[model samples]
Target: MDMTTQHITLGAINMEAENPVELAAFWGTVTSAVPSVGGGTVYLPPAGPGGFAMFFRPMAGPRLERQAAHLDLTVPWGSRQAEVDRLLSLGATYKWDVLDEVPHVQWTTLADPEGNLFCVAEHPPAS
Candidate 1:
């Protein structure tokens, strides 16, 4: 395999929602990513360079089970709680909080309006 001859980049993270426009709006507000709509789908451009965009499409039927993957958003040290609060105000519901003393990390799990899970985390500064 010639690894150097082939280039691969993450294009987007796609998900299904009952209302794609509303779901995209929630994520767009949370990540500050502007959205573009077309072809029955809503796309949010990456928040910054090298970041992958997010795409939301209409669901054909009710989701029967929890999603196997979720997004974990990192915030500056000591800001996880505030970010979680802000997300809640923007229509996210609290799931739980994980505070690990072994590594001294904190993160709060949350679900979007449509029940998609995600997290906000704060990590210790590099020593």
Candidate 2:
């Protein structure tokens, strides 16, 4: 099966938010994306040609349930703590410690301002 034969290409990953502008700005900073708005929704340009990007749309509802999918962010090798500190200062909340709960993993679970969960870890150094 030739996967390229499938015409479907991922355009973006979108998240439902109460405030699309705010969430989009947060995600833009997180991913270093160039953010733009269209039809009241936010779009972030991909890092490169044909790369998958991000979007955020407004949603009105009660409290959101835990999502099965979450983001795993990486920092430069050995900078996990510093990155976590920076994100925390930028309005991210500490959720849980992976090493404390899982015993070996060196990741920390965190939540964005809107309570969307994500993880931050150190990227392995280049060989």
Sliding window of 10 residues with minimal summed lDDT for model 1:
1-10
Candidate 2 local lDDT, residue 27:
74
Write model 2 residue lDDT over 12-120, tens digit each, in one string: 8878888888988887777667789888799887867645688888885765576889887766667888888888988899988665544334788899989999999
Candidate 2 global Cα RMSD: 3.4
lDDT of model number 1: 0.90
Q: List ranges where model 2 is wrong by over 4 Å.
A: 1-10, 48-52, 100-104, 123-127
Against the true structure, candidate 2 reaches a TM-score of: 0.77
What stretches of model 1 exceed 4 Å from their correct place?
Answer: 5-8, 101-104
Residue-pair clashes per candidate? 0, 0
